[model samples]
Target: MHQNPGGLSAAEIHTERKEQQRRRRNSLLLVVPILLFLFFAFVAPISSMLHRSIYNPTLVELIPDTINALSSWDRTGTPKPETLRTFSIELQQLAKQRESGRLASAVNRSYPGATSLINATARKLRNVDPNQLAQTGHLALLDTDPRWSETKLWQAIDRLGAKYRIDNYLTALDLERDAQGNIQKRQSSNIYIDLYSKTLSMSLIITLLCIALGYPVAYCLAHAPARIAGVLLVMVLLPFWTSFLVRTTAWIALLQTNGVINSVLQSVGIIHQPLELLYTPLATILAMTHILLPFMILPLYSVMKGIDPSHVKAALSLGSPPFSAFVRVYLPQTVPGLSAGSLLVFITAVGYYIIPALVGGTEGQMISNIIAYHMQQSNNWGLASALGSLLLAVIVILYWLYDRLVGASNLKLS
Candidate 1:
């Protein structure tokens, strides 16, 4: 009931403050669910994957006493008597716990043939008396397997004993630590580096192809009459309406040696024999381009629709050639769309798994296929996580470069 000098009552001011607080509370309530969903669904999984890339605990947990003993021995010399005794006792306990396989599997990641040796030793130790093992020490272990005397096997065990390591990442990059602990290129044939290079190159080629094919379609859609433009836009987006798997399958059917495309070509007398099209890198590129073409077209169409045709006309009216007017005036205006579409297509193409895996035979497989192989077939989660993390890092770096060169704020989409 109290009136202020400005003619508003104190009650009115209190009501305004209460209304503002209520609105803020409602806004926060709406956002809380989305934030929780992101943390649990997206953020948490990525954090766990990144952590797995560096963390490994199977060996250390399975043979703690042995790891403790190895900590004291100089990796350069042969194992001491006490260290050997500790390793023997731990190996017996690990076998009794049925965990020798886990240890062997972990070791096999670094030294290929060590799994069989470790398993064999565990089997041999199962028959020997623990008391005899304690008494005989290093000699008993050597009788079980001469490889136990090898420094390299011990070195592999020592490496896995660490709870966290960079070995996964190093291996993903086709590099490893030598016996001297020096970082060096792996002795094995390098596959990861080549796969990474191929991934990048293919992504680049796909992005360029999408841009080349999408631009004309977008331009036509943007400039046509309203009814015509709507029809054209629908045609551009028709592929997206279909199932992705169906589209990929259709491409395989069309590109197969005796499939629709080859049949049409032969019917037209283009060739006597069918050309090998399916399961090739060219098929991968073509299918990916088709799958991603709409992404490019939508952004380009959105930008072109907003552009005033009069600007290009004004440039032409000033005596500039038509091509020159377009290059200098219209093309520059569409750059934001071009950049957004290219980045979207490139990033998506780099992570492509299904298309490349199904269409791309051995010669066309990408890094994502390798990651899947390690995860599912090899059961090498650490290596898979490392490859995924490296791919994520590459994407982040590319995004940072794009943002620096062409402001992310400039990106537009329909």
Candidate 2:
């Protein structure tokens, strides 16, 4: 071993090669568990959800014969008896598999006539032995039901069975389809679109309010003495230390008819009435602004803190107006923080549920409320998923747009 100090002997060279191979093998072994974890935990769930979104399980697997056979017919016209026969057989198989409910449910979503489609097929199936499903006479047995001759019924079945559709998207938009694939908005007076609009509008309003209030506060904190800044920052962070629900509940009590704000206002003769503040849009905006103000303040403070004080001093030395110097020199530097804070607050506010549910009126309730409604009140997973997916899409697009706009501006500056 001592003789191999300057150069590797054959045994030493082999040992070094073995050590390198062991490291490579260990690294590969380490990577495998991480990749497997990502696949199982993150990737698999997302793939499953996306699959569920387009998952038309009832028709595709059950009625393959009918879907394949009806490739040429117009939905508005009558279909031949052979098509009905194909559907009838598929329905019988589906019933045997205990999947007829899914078929009926899917058909009910697309067309009213198919309410009895599955039941009719099931009844016919009951009358005959399982071996007789292939017999020609089974077709006549199905023809007894008027749904068997309905072209739109078969079309709906085929769609629910075969199509990877935008129907869920339309439904989230409070729209639907007709027999000819034409889209129409829902005529219901109460719907998801209203909730969606309210959500966006409320979020935007809250974001603007946060910026207006938080900007000055953050500016003061940024330019203050270090001790003062520390105190203000501690105050800003204090809410975060408290439980979110506790803060929201505190707001509920404070905004109530006999609560502190109303009591003080009445004592000062500002208004005689409590003014319905607790369950109004004002309460939602106020509470959300209070809760989200720190989000706006911290980012703005970070940006403002990094700014050179001499920039404004230089502008002032050049005979620029104080306000003008501040606007010209100070405001542009804060864009990064402003954009960051707005994006954070808006994204969080849009998906807000608990705060709005507690303080928002019927008029102020957001889309998340409706999603929760469908999940808890209605137990309609498809509708809820459609809404959830749409909300997620909206957030994604908004973030993308924010990134592009901010990135472009940053590029121009550089």
Candidate 3:
């Protein structure tokens, strides 16, 4: 029998290879469900958000012929008469379908009085015969609204007619391009940048507060007797058993002007009047810190549980000062958990919505509140997606900076 030196037979080796391939296929099959879940849950929504931020099809779909006609004419003046006639016919069709609302909204985002311009022209066009729309519809539209005579109105149509745009991102950043296409600060709606700063600042404060408050509790839980540690750990995790909304509303009761805290303070003679604490930034910070403190403590306690108490004792045995022993020998061991908990708390605090929305009055509203405003109230999903994409980018960049400078995965053991 002929065989390779390392194999019993070529057929045997081939059978083994088939067995390995089958195992590999089975392994992949086992994970396919999770992979599909991740793709649909995370990747799909993110892709949709990214696409919405740039590609809006409302204007392009509503008046494709009008946009195609405007393509030939320079944007320096009113579009050609044919383009106006085509736009009038499309508006008439949309009016018939009751779909003018979306177009009016899209147009108004770009140009003022766009609803009036589009709706009024639609009203005027219902009287025009569709067959004659190609002949005299442009004149009818001009008679309906003299604003159509203006260059800016046509410019907005031509701009929004394209399927892809960066205007949403520009507006999200409180910026705009001038007529000459130079990027400049927007005179109107110049609040997004400030909101981003406030969000980041508030998130940082919440992280720090979580650390200051959670670290001691975590250390105590880690070092206490097993019986006491189990009870303390329950206290830490007790918040999870309650509904999140219930927990947040409990703060509403505590911080409200005539609520438990104010009544207690008044009874104790600490103050005569109730404080305006419920709907302010301080309330946002405190509530968020409370909600996120357990995130810090749990990670810290987990890490601290595995840490050796003898490390600090050994440092003191070597004649090191107590503070020096704690800092130099013991503190390094907790860096992994500290970084993880900080990152968890900070990211959660940054994207927080319900807490801020419930308690954050006008003065305390964060960037997420503005994003919700754009999506829910204003129906400006493009701007909301752009803001969300920007927020995601900021968190990613900050994480990258942290990994580079602090190295979150850097585990030090001595």
- Winning model by lDDT: 1
TM-score of every candidate relative to the true structure = 0.93, 0.76, 0.95
Which candidate has the top score in TM-score?
3
Candidate 2 lowest-lDDT run of ten: 133-142
| Tens-digit lDDT string for candidate 3 (82-167) | 88888889889998888887888899987878988787777768767887888888888888878988988888888888899999
What are the clashing pairs of model 1?
Answer: none
lDDT of 1: 0.90
Model 3 misplacement above 4 A: 408-414
Candidate 3 versus truth, CA RMSD in Å, comes to 1.8
Which residue runs does candidate 1 get wrong by more than 4 Å? 1-18, 408-414
RMSD after CA superposition, every candidate: 2.7, 5.1, 1.8
Candidate 2: RMSD over Cα atoms? 5.1
Tens-digit per-residue lDDT, 188-275, candidate 2: 6647777778788889999999999999999999989999999999999999999999999998899999999999999999999886
Query: Candidate 3 — which pairs collide?
Result: none
